[model samples]
Target: MSSSAGTSTQGEPLNATALNRQLKVMQDRINQLEAQLQAGSGAPRAKAGEGTPKERKRVKLSAPREFDGQQAALAGFLIQMQAYLHFYEDQFASEFEKVTYAGTRLVDKALTWFEPILKDYYENGDQATDFTKKVLNSYADFTEALSRVFGEKDEARRAQERLTHLRQTKMHFAATSTTTG
Candidate 1:
C-alpha cells in the first residue's frame, strides 16, 4: 500500500487532509487578491509621515467641510434611504436564491422600475426635503403594491408605511411648533 498525496497509484483515493490543505491555500490566495483589489492601488499603506510632502499635504487638504443643520439632515436622510435600498436589494437577492428564475426576473423588473427614482435622488441635492418625501412616499407605494401582488401582509411593507407616516407627522409637528412656540 502506497500513500502518495497527489496521484493515486494503485487506484487509491486522494487524501482528504491533502485536499483540505490545498483548498485552504487557495482560499488564502483568494483573500490576498481580494484585499489587494479593495486597496485600489494594491500597495501597502504607508506609515504616518512616511509619504512625500505632496501626498501628506493632499491628505490634509481632503478634510470634509462642516455641514449646517439642513444639509446635515438631508445627508442623514439620503444615507437612510440608501441603506433601505440596500436592504431591499439583499432581500431580493435572497428571494432569487430561494425561488424560480421567473420569480427573480419579476423582482428584477420591479427594481428596474424603481431605479430611476433612486438615480434622480442621487443626482439632485437641491430640494432635498421634497425629494426625500417623494422617495419615502414612493417606497411606501411600492411596498403596498408588492403586498397586494404577493397576496399577504408583509411586515417590511407595513414598516415602510409607518416610517412614511411618522416622517410626515414629524414634519408637520416641526412646522406647527415653530409657528406656535
Candidate 2:
C-alpha cells in the first residue's frame, strides 16, 4: 500500500505547483468562454433587405439652399450691359442693326425677369434705391437724346449733345421705378 501511494505521489507536482497549473487551466477556459460570448454577440447583424453594409439606407442633406432672385437679376443685367457696350465700336457698327436687335432682346428679357422684383420693391416703397437710381439716371439721359432727335432747338446739335451725354454717362435703365403707376 505504501509503495502504490509513493508511485502516485511521484507523478504529481508539489501543492503550489499543482495549484498554479490548475489556475492556468481555469484562466485559459475563461478566456475561451469570453471569446465565444463576444463572437456570438457580434454575429453578422441581419440587414433588412438593404443591399450591402457600404450602401447607405438613407440620404440626408446638411443645409438648405439660399438664393435671392433680385440679386440674380441685377447681376444678369450688368452682364448684358457690358456685352452691349463692347459692341459699340466702329467695327461693330457694320452689324449695327443686328446688334441693336440683340440688345433690345436682352433688355426685354432682363425687364421680364426683373419685373417681379421691381413690382415687389415699388409695392414695398423701397424703389428709389441703389441700382435703381443709376438706371433711372441713365434712362433720363437716353430719353433726353430721344427728345432731341424728334426736333428740339438745334435738332442736330441737341441730338449730338444727347448722344455725347449718353456716351459719357454710359448709363442703363433702372430695374425698378420709384414713382408708382
All candidates: TM-score: 0.19, 0.17
lDDT of 2 at 77: 40
Could you tell me which residue pairs clash in candidate 1?
Answer: none
Q: Write the per-residue lDDT of candidate 1 for residues 16-89, one digit (tens) a residue.
A: 77667766877999998888879877656667888885555332222122212232243443344445445445
Per-residue lDDT of candidate 2, residues 71-113 (tens digit): 3344344344345445443324333232233324333433454
Cand. 1 Cα-lDDT: 0.46
lDDT minimum window of 10 residues, candidate 2: 60-69
Instruction: Tell me the deviation in Å of residue 134 in model 1.
Output: 2.8
Which ranges of candidate 1 are over 4 A from the true structure?
1-107, 126-132, 137-139, 145-181
lDDT for 85 (candidate 2) = 47
Overall local distance difference test of candidate 2: 0.44
